[model samples]
Target: MLKTTVLNTAHRALGARMVDFGGWEMPLHYGSQIEEHHAVRRDCGMFDVSHMCAVEALGPDVKTFLLRLIANDIGKLKTPGKALYSTLLNEAGGVVDDLIVYYLSDTHYRLVINAGSTDKDLAWMAERLCEWRLDVCLIPLRTGPTAVAMIAVQGPHAKARVWEVLPEVRPATEKPGPFFAVEVGPLCIATTGYTGEEGFELTVPAAQAEDIWNALLAAGVKPCGLGARDTLRLEAGMNLYGQDMDESVSPLDAGLAWTVDLASERDFVGKAALLEKGRQRQFLGLKLLTQGVLRAHQKVVTAQGEGDITSGSFSPTLGCSIAFARLPLGVAIGDRVKVEIRGKRLDAEVTRPLFVRHGKALI
Candidate 1:
């Protein structure tokens, strides 16, 4: 059975093209995907992200348990509602899943994980607790009386629109420092986003989603879809799991070395494996010099050796194709490479990731 969000009818009413995304029926676009992408870059746009799973961890040992499970240190979150982005790793240092952990209190923490990986992630966390005999409680926060729906409002004017719609949340949402969140009534407003824009990811009760969405629409916030979300995140140089990485890929090979806190004295999962194979192949950004769309699993040929594109797409903001590739260590910035697209070799340049931000092209 395909799962539907609370706003399914609303999306259809807006003429959004719906598609099956990872077992969930989701909106692909409300008319033109490119137009929606531009709206988020130049103005404000909203996305229905209710399919994402939110889990809460409780117990006095929550912090201690997290320190051992994630690659990033949770102790760094000194203030309440502070958020940390980290990757869960297996014993071999391979990425289990990348997630956002929010510190709510001394004995409480909230986690938001990818929708597709929710079942596996919950099961994995539970099994780890039993195997390690860790004294903690894990709870899955399903959308119901206690849990709620989440919507991501992104773009340059995203905050402004949010303030206009829900004026009562203005004070709390005003000074949400980067990677921080605040709870207002039933809404958890966070100044964080996947797209490289100033925005907020709001979590509200399922029943309240329609009201908020209607208010935002009246406030001139355009309804965006997953198509725009994908393009926007790609332009921002963010990795998409199951495409850019999976359980077989390590953070070190996915251009996420900075997220791994290896220098600290804190112990974490997959630390030993990271230390052992940290200097292998390197992950980098690729700008296609030829007129061709880059796609995942394409072969990349460099002077040093051959590799593959982890994530690739035609950037709507850049008006060109860009990609992330895991290539041999010898390949450096400014180096040229060839990508095999549709049985033809296309020229591309090796460069740093993040091709666009705040409606401007960076590469």
Candidate 2:
């Protein structure tokens, strides 16, 4: 039983190549994947991210519930609409999932979690709320009136084009800060994106999904698919949840240590385990020097030891192969290494995990 988003029919009508992505039927590409990737880099492109779960927790105890459930501190959100990225960890210090939480008010917080981890994430939070006797109740966006279409409009021109299509969303986003969200009526627009470009992720009702999609299309925002989304995120140095990190992996090796809040003694889940786990491996960026397609699970041979590539792709913007690898902590930037691609060793170099941001190359 595969799930489908509100844009399922629209994607098929546009001649999109569809595939199973995390149990959801999703578009891999509409036509030329490289063309779609460039469209997002140069102009604006939209992706139907309705498969992602938008779970909202509300109550007087909501803030306290989150403070104990996630690795990051929700107390950091001093202002309304402020969003925080956190790793939801288990009792053993392994990552359960990485999610973005938005503070709407003192009693209301919205969590946009990965589609694959929704069930486990809900169960975990539910048990904790019961145990702590917190009054928080989790509400998934897919149910009832809260059901909405999650669309991502990305690129340097993304925001301007969004205003052209849905002008009503502008006044709410006037504060103009990164990692912040604004709710106008039933619409929730957040100034956050998986791609390293300026964009706003829109959450609108399921009934109005096609209308909004068409409006954006008419406003010159091209339609993109998961294929283009992958290439764009790779160039931008964003992590794909299941591949980059999982329940068996820790944030220390997943290039997500910054999201882990260890400054306070608030006693979040997995804090003790994380303190005991002295990072053995590190997450670093890889640029293939030789001509070849870098793929995941490929063995990387560094001078220190052998490691593996977690996520890899041919970057459309950079016109080269880039990947994220979990390597020995001693692996420094500018260190030469070899990647085993199809039994043939290829030349590569190690650098920082971030490759590009704001449509510009950092490496």
Candidate 3:
């Protein structure tokens, strides 16, 4: 059965082109995808991200359990409500999932995970908690009794616009800097977003999703769908879990080296295996010099060797084809490579993995 979010009816009412995304009925677009993408870049736009799960970890062993699970160090999140992005790894050092962990208190933390990863993530965390004999409760809150709903309001004017509808939340939301969260009554307002723009991702009671959604729309926030969300995150150079990486890909080899804190003496699930498996291929960015749509699974022919494109798309902001590729180590910035598309070869230039941030094109 295809799951539906709390705002499914609202999306259909807005004439959204619905699609089955990760076993869920999701909105592809609210009509014009280009306009929606630009709306987020220029103004403010919102995405119904209710399908994403917010798993809560409570009990005395919560912090210790997390330190032994994800690749990033949780100790860095000393400030309450501070969020840390981490890549949960499997035994062979492959990425199980990438999620955000917010340190709520000494014995409490909240993790936001991908919708598709809901089941596996919860199970994996449970197995570890049991094996470690930790006194912690890992509750998956996207479904079951504690289910919640979420929305992401993004862009340069995102904060101001969101505040217009959530005036009561303004005072508390204003204090959190980047990668932080604050509780505003029933809402968990976080200064975090997938799009490389300033925004807040709000988690509220499932029953209250409609009211908040309607309020944001009345506040002039453009309703965006998964289509614009995909392009926006891709242009921002953020990795999509299943597309850009999976259980077979290592975070160190997937352009996420910075998120891994291997320097610490703390022993995580995949630390030993990760340290053993050094960089096999380099993950970098590419800009096409030719006119063509760059898509995933395309072959990249570098001067040193061959590679495959992990994620690619026509960037609405850059007005060109941009992509992330795991190429041979010899390929460096300023180097040119050929990509195979439709059995034809096109030239592209190697650049930094990050394409844009804060609505400005970096490369």
**Best-fitting candidate, scored by lDDT:** 3
| Candidate 3 wrong stretches, greater than 4 Å | none
Sort by lDDT, top down from the best: 3, 2, 1
lDDT of 3 at 105: 93
lDDT of 1 by residue, 1-363 (tens): 899989999999999999999899999999999999999999999999999998989997888889999899888998999998989999899888999999999799999999999999999999888887877888776755876888999999999899988899999888777899999887899988988999999999888899999899989999999999999998888999898878999898998887899998888889999998875788889999989898899999988889999888888888889999999989999998999988899899998878888888887
What would the TM-scores of all predictions be? 0.98, 0.98, 0.98
**Model 2, 257-339: lDDT tens per residue?**
88888878899988898899857798999999989988999999999999999999998888889999999878999999999
> What is candidate 3's lDDT per residue for 232-257, written digit by digit as tens?
99888899999888999988889898
Name the regions of candidate 2 deviating beyond 4 angstroms.
Answer: none
Between prediction 2 and prediction 3, the one with superior lDDT is 3
For candidate 2, give the lDDT of residue 107. 95
Error of 3 at 91 (Å): 1.0
